[model samples]
Target chain A: MSFIQRAVKVPPNSVSLEEARHRVFDFFRAACRSIPTIMEIYNLDDVVAPSHLRSVVASEIRKNSSVTNPKVIDMLLFKAMEELNNITEHAKQRHHIIGQYVVGHQGLVQDLGTKDQGASGFLKDFYKSNYF
Target chain B: MALRAALLRHVRIPAQTLNPALTLTGGKWGPPSLRWMSSHDDHLTKSEVTERVLSVVKSFPKVDPSTVTSDVHFQKDLGLDSLDNVEIVMALEEEFKLEIPDKEADKIDSTNLAIEYIYNHPMAG
Candidate 1:
């Protein structure tokens, strides 16, 4: 039996230059506003300041000046959204100290009040090798 | 063309050697010139680190400043949970302008530990 491969269809560019520009500007503004909160939650305030985040985003926007191509703008927007999602996820994970400790321990000990168990045999072996 | 070349030559050499010359040239050339004048006062002493660490610990809403001492532990003295401890470490990292590695960060359970870490860090400014 012969397998047929279908060509991926590229979506038509429907967004106007003004709309794309506005979207990019809005994305930057939203990202800038959230930088402080993201930094606080993710413990990145030391590494990344609000102004630094803004300048970085500004540089990215300036680097890509293909406003005429809506697809390019869409790709940029999608990347920005993905970045925001990643930061948010990191912040959420790192916001609590317990999670940080558990993660740092290389998942040896699982959390309390949770049925999720770690590698109990490995943990035993670790204790035997290290302690005994 | 000759005059412009001479002017460029006059501006370029002094800009590289002297900051004041660069500033003067920068003023003349508007914001187009890339004369990066970075100030060099980014060193923090041990005493400053101690003070900053104390301040950061004290600033925690749950922690009482009157009861807080350098030797006080986050969990035992301040009654802070692990989350609070993480936040405190993060605050110290922000205050000291340095990244405390996960292992070291975990070990910083007390104000004194945080102070010592920040004080020893060469890049903490």
Candidate 2:
């Protein structure tokens, strides 16, 4: 499933304090890896600037410095991930509208009326629709 | 005018050269200007920095490539808080092979920001 879909399985306010404490570090690790990707996706116009992204991340970490709850941290991190997914997905769709995201959508080619829609079918349809 | 709270504590970045992924985030490595990416240039190339970083993060049981993003909150997004930041800092320090001051720990939140900071700062070699 896509990133946003995972949020449905989690309750927003259900962060367990114990989990929050242990999970805070895990959240940071993921955030660090994701920064570059996030920068690429939301940075379409460079309007927000990389510094702002960094600053917000740093700011969030600062607030949780004292929290020892792992679950709480996990839920918080999960929320951020969901937001990022939503924003980026929206950005991708918008880009599709403007034709900027065209090349990447070639994955849809296989989904065309080809007999059996397998992964290859999706790719074939994706290329035909998006590329051709 | 706006007060910035302590974000993270001591995120250590290694002294080693970073990969294209992290290095590219700064103004180094390639042409100063942005040109269209060519077929020869796949975006996944990593420098020492990237490898070291990936090593540290990949060691963790939680992070997946799909879930990583710029806005993923360290605490909320990846499930990290202050103390974990400490471990992250130490790992980065080892990976990049440098010293990250405790005082500076709170400031390094995103890898993009860290790359930007490191590029501008004196320590990144």
Question: By lDDT, who's the top model here?
Answer: 1
DockQ of each: 0.01, 0.06
Query: What tens digits encode model 1's per-residue C-alpha lDDT throughout B25-92?
Result: 54655666454453334667778777888988887777889998878989998897654676677666
How does model 2 do on interface RMSD, in angstroms? 6.6
TM-score of chain B of 2: 0.47
lDDT for model 1: 0.63
A1-132 per-residue lDDT for model 1 (tens digits) = 111111122334547876676566556655655656776776765544554444455655666764568767877677666657556556345533223322223334444434434547765456434311
In DockQ terms, which candidate is top?
2
* Candidate 1 chain A, run of 10 with poorest lDDT: A1-10
lDDT of 2: 0.51
* Model 2 alpha-carbon drift over 4 Å, by segment: A1-4, A11-18, A44-52, A64-75, A88-132, B1-125
Query: What is the TM-score of model 1 when looking only at chain B?
Result: 0.65
- Estimate the TM-score of every prediction: 0.38, 0.32
Tens-place lDDT per residue, model 2, A57-117, is 5555666566565665666667766655564455454444223232233433334564645
Worst 10 residues of 2 chain B by lDDT: B1-10
Candidate number of the best TM-score: 1
